[model samples]
Target: MNIEVNSQNLKFLECFASDTRIKIIELLNERPMNIKDLAESLGFSSAIVTKHVQKLEEAFIITTESVPSTRGRQKICHLTLESATLQFRAKKQDDQNRYAVSIPIGQYSAYDVKPTCGLASDTKIIGMVDDPRYFSDPEHVKACHLWFGSGFIEYRIPNYLVGKQSVRSLSISLEICSEAPHYNENWPSDLTFYINDTCLGAWTCPGDFGAVKGVYTPSWWKLGTQHGLLKQITVDSEGSYIDGIRISDRTVQDLAIHYGDDIRFRISAPETAAHSGGLSMFGKQFGNYDQDIQVYVAY
Candidate 1:
């Protein structure tokens, strides 16, 4: 059978094509950095470094998050994969084809949010901070992005697969990072994913994002939190994968999802987490990537 990554695979190669971004990667190989440090090290303007970093992130090469700084929020860029390579040939007879769909960040069917939390659309805040009451506002459906310090949010993935829906595999993609009362470069959070109540696995997000402008972020948003790393969580008979890399033994059969059933995707920052850093999510109208939470079903 054939294989593919979460985002466009070529997008990763495109990131290496840039000389400036290569330098950034090289530096990160030595240590992670914030925008200010990268700018200073590269002798480039903060704006310029931000652009290059975004390109690397779009391709899933590097990830950025915000942390506490004397000047306020600071962004730390970390290297994801040291190096990645690919091969392209002809599609095999057993090659599997798939269908895809996208959901906005704010359109969750249910939510249990807490203080140090709030929601924002592409253009404005959904409601006042720390007020779960506003999460029910009909306007929330229009939100392109949202954030919360603690708790979990769940979205209903619409049933759209038609024909022989063998449902060989299922996947969800989103831009996300750890959340905190305020940005902290060193902050860590254990982010967990669940499908139909089955705990797939947990990924640690270093910190919340802020301090720079997201590529598609609205000007109305202050100069903090551009976006988070674009990631894909997938499940199949083969088990689970994070950005195409195996993370656990949990598989599609574990969830027992069928074509007629509604697929629920939930992200949680439970109290027992080692970090409890919180979480922040981005939508199409926000973040460097111009896509929302994407769901892919391969049969």
Candidate 2:
């Protein structure tokens, strides 16, 4: 996870403010445990530990799931975020030089998804869950959240660069994560990105998130995929980067993008990948970050 040191991320930062939360994190790091077990380990009451758990869950540092136990149902807490990078500085860019657009998650021009896949609008499921044929249902355009165990999804983006506007950099941001059956904090998925067919390298999503409800997700949603990590992929004059870390040597010039060209962006998780856990994409109405796939062309 990569986060900026700013007001917007204060909640996540605050997760480390308390010693109790820190100890809870350390204990969970070794293994997933229920509230009763955690409280006993910390010499605290279940109610007190529950409060601490909620704080960590809000920060996305941990996830909890209700499962059958000897005593009935138990909420087992698991460590979700394995690591995080705190970015205190960012390079300044002129907004005047850029044109941006937000692409809804389901507005894909083409896709090839397998089973354990489905789509959902803010109000209901798009079609049948785990059925690929439903991906083509006319109502798919209304989807705010979508996931697949494997395969790819593509989107067509309009290139708005006008007369002689040479590209400086191209930025794409979205909330995404691994797709596990129900949910799994330890699952990893190798996700690859493409621009007009040019490979931008791949990123390994750490896990499928749903340990708690997403801030923007519908209250009735219980599919286990609550939210995802926000990722920023950029291609500039020098190279391509994911969350400021260079992933590939592919550059804007290498992409050869020109005025009036339609950009085809693809996100895929091939079954042959080392991780192959799958992928889940969240839109403005489905994830912690209330935004769709945002694209920016800077020239």
Candidate 3:
């Protein structure tokens, strides 16, 4: 996340002013917690913790959801923003040499999935849950969220390079995580990436997060994965990177992409992987980030 030094962003800056909120952020960094848990840990009353939580939520630093509990419904809180950058100066505005494409999560051209798989749109589930056949349903194209126990999904993206345009780097950003029954914070999945057919290596997502509802997740979505970590995978002339850390030696040149070429991207969590935990993808209306599979090409 990026923030500018302006009055419009004062609320976000103010979130860090209080020591109580700072402590709340610290505890949430370890794991998601409810208001009662936070209160107990901070030696404060639930009402005080709730007030602090409201402030954090308003700042878009955290998310909360009410879920069933032994007593009744309790509000669980989850940390949302992983990191933020405070920009002190303006940078050059240049976008002519670059182009971006946003592919809906459900617009995959090919797929092979196992049970515990399903798709959902912003309004409703497309078909029966845990049914792989539904992946081929016509309504699949409108899905904003998708998951499977194992296997792969493939998307064919258009290469927008015009005459004389080449490539510098390709960055694909999406919201993804491991898939488990309902939710789990510790399930790890080794999700591999392939461009065209070349392997760009794999990333291990930590878990299926449902500790709290996603900020944009519909209220009707209950008892399931609520959110995922926003990850950016970039392939440059040097190598492939997840977020900003190098993940493999695969380079953009290796893709051999050209004008009018087809960019077939694949995400797989094969059963043969060490973790084999499964995969889940969240789209604009389902995850914290209001975006689909964002593909940015710098030429």
Report the C-alpha lDDT of model 1 over 1-299, residue by residue, as the tens digit.
12344355667767768888889999998777999899999999999999999988887677787779888899889775532324355223343467777888878899898767777887788878778788888999888777777899999987766665667788787888877665665678899999988899998987666644566788798735567767778798888877667778998878867768888889998877888888888888887678889888767
Residue pairs in steric clash, candidate 2? none
Candidate that beats the other on lDDT, 2 or 3, i.e. the better one: 2
lDDT of each residue in 20-126, candidate 3, tens digit only: 99999999999889999999999999999999999999988998878899999999898898766676683333699888999999999999999789999999998
CA deviation > 4 Å runs, candidate 1:
1-21, 27-97, 161-164
TM-score per candidate, chains pooled: 0.74, 0.76, 0.81
* Tens-digit lDDT string for candidate 2 (1-299): 46889999998999999999999999997878999999999999999999999989988788787889988999989775656778899556798988999999989999999978999999999989999999999999999999999999999888887899888888898999999999997899999999989999999998998776676789879889888888889899999999889999999998868888898899999999999999999998887777899998888
Cα RMSD of all models vs. native, in order, equals 6.6, 4.7, 4.0
TM-score of 1: 0.74
Model 2 lDDT vs. the true structure?
Answer: 0.90
